[model samples]
Target: MVGLLLVVTLLTYIIPAGQYARDTAGNILTDDQFSYLDEQTPVSILDMLMLLMDGLIS
Candidate 1:
C-alpha cells in the first residue's frame, strides 16, 4: 500500500494534470468541451498524503 502511494505521488509530478468543463447542470462535458490547459499546478507532497488518507478512509 505504501509502495502504491509512493508510485502515485511520483506520478503526480510526472503527469500533466487537466480539468474537465462542467455544464450548468453539473454534468461533465464531452470531448468537444474538454480542454487541456497550458499550466499545471503542482500537487504538494503533503496534499498527496492527505489525498491518500482521504481515499483510504472513504
Candidate 2:
C-alpha cells in the first residue's frame, strides 16, 4: 500500500494540474474554460497519513 502511494505521489509530480472555470452558480463548468492551474500542489506524505488515519476511524 505504501509503495502504491509512493508511485501515485511521483505520478502527481510528473502530471500537470488543471482546473475548469465554473459557472455563475458555481455548480457547472461553463463552455471551454478548462485551463491549467497557476501552481502545482502535490500531496504531501503527512496529508496521505492523515487520510489513512481518517479512513481507519471511519
Candidate 3:
C-alpha cells in the first residue's frame, strides 16, 4: 500500500547504512578545527573595509 511504501522510503534515508559518509564528515570537521587553531590573527569585515577606505582616500 502507499503507507507501507512511504515507511520503507523514509527508513532508507534515516538509516546510517554506510560508514563512509560518517567518516568523511568527521575528517572535515577535524580539519576545520585544526586550521582554525593555526590562524594567529583573524581580521574582521569592518577592519578590512576601514583599511580599504584609507587606501582609497589617501
Candidate 4:
C-alpha cells in the first residue's frame, strides 16, 4: 500500500543513523556523558521503531 511505501522511504534515512550513533558512542560521547545526551535527545519509541523498519528495508 501507499502507506507502507511511504514508511519504507522514511525509514531508509533513520536506521543507519541509529546504528552509527550506537557504534560511535565512544567517539562521540562517553557512557554516562552519552546518557545525558540521550535524555536531551528527542528520539522516541516511534522513532526507534522507524529506524528498525529502515534497517529491514536496507
Model 2 worst lDDT window (10 residues): 5-14
The TM-score obtained by model 4 is 0.30
Cα RMSD for predicted model 4: 10.2
Model 3, span 1-58: residue lDDT tens? 5466456555654543422222455553332322222223434445555756798799
**lDDT tens readout by residue for model 2, 1-58:** 8899878877777889998899889999877887898889887778877878899999
TM-score of 3: 0.30
Which candidate order results from sorting by TM-score in descending order? 2, 1, 4, 3
* Superposed Cα deviation of residue 40, candidate 2 (Å): 0.9
Off by over 4 Å in 3: 1-39
Clashes of each: 0, 0, 0, 0
Residue 10 alpha-carbon offset, candidate 2, angstroms: 1.6
What TM-score against the true fold does each predicted structure earn?
0.57, 0.63, 0.30, 0.30
Off by over 4 Å in 1: 44-47, 50-58
lDDT of each: 0.77, 0.85, 0.47, 0.53
Between the candidate structures 2 and 3, which one is better when assessed by TM-score? 2
RMSD of each: 2.9, 2.3, 19.2, 10.2
Return the top candidate by lDDT. 2
Judging by TM-score against the true structure, name the best candidate. 2
lDDT of 4 at 27: 60
